[model samples]
Target: MKSYEYIEEVKRANGLDTDYKVAKLLGCGQNKITQYRAGQTMDNETARQIAEILDIPVWQIIADMESERQKDPSKKKAWKMLAKLSKQAGAATYNLLILNSIISFLVIYYAL
Candidate 1:
């Protein structure tokens, strides 16, 4: 997702009414948030924090942000690929967790 989209999601999820509140949560100034909204690439640290807040893979966020920051076509392509792979990995992890929970529930039910 784009940086602005991430900020919008954060604001919606956290009930943040303004960029200032989101900035406080992100440990940055409101202008930084504005910059991001204005199409600036978010820094790595900010990406990490956003990942934590959004409960997504840090690598995914990092890759996405890096993709935006990269000027070279090859570098941008690589970052985009990394972001795609990380997103798939995250989905796989989540599916595994769900499967594990189902298996555990079945085992417990059978034992009882």
Candidate 2:
């Protein structure tokens, strides 16, 4: 299931016509939808945006087709890496926010 197939499945499931509605939901131009439907390749950013709009797991949609092309062991490793990366990235972002807040507090205290 390529991203395009995944998208079409979503549209059919939702009973939507034309890629315009999908584009609106995804905050992209209608042409992007057309390109996807036409089987033109899209970058990861665009694929992520579409996944966000459709409320689907980005990896699930993007990896479905690619995973089928890989050996079972390799595909499993890829999934594990994806999960680990997502978790680590989220934690790193939260840590950054905490650090920023501490720095801000220190700055304010010194100023006072």
Candidate 3:
């Protein structure tokens, strides 16, 4: 499952008539949708929007496509790097959110 395939699946799941219209709704050019359907790379924003429109988790779509990409021997290195980066970023972001919540709680408690 490539980006295009994911987009197509989302469109189908949402009962969308045309990829062009999906692109329009996502605020991208129609050609972007066509290119995605043709197996071209998609930006993260577009991928997120497609996931949102289909009511699916963006990570689920990304994970499915990444799994498919990993099946190709040539992409193994890239896949590994991507997985490492995703993990690092996810952990860092979660930690930041936790820290922020703690700080916010402390501020409110001190004020009270």
| Model number with the top TM-score | 1
User: What TM-score does prediction 3 earn?
Assistant: 0.53
List, residue by residue over 4-109, the lDDT tens digit for candidate 2: 7756765776677868876776678988878777766556776677566555556654454444445688785686566456545656766898999999999999
Tens-digit lDDT track of model 1 for 58-89: 99988988899889999999999999999899
Tell me the TM-score of each prediction against the true structure: 0.92, 0.47, 0.53
* Residue 99, candidate 3: alpha-carbon lDDT: 100
Clashing pairs in 1: none
Ranked by TM-score from best down, the candidates are 1, 3, 2
Candidate 1 residues lying further than 4 Å off, grouped into runs, are none
lDDT of 1: 0.93
Deviation from native of the Cα of residue 9 in model 2, angstroms:
2.6
Provide the lDDT at 66 for model 1: 89
By TM-score, the better pick of 2 and 3 is 3
lDDT of 2: 0.66
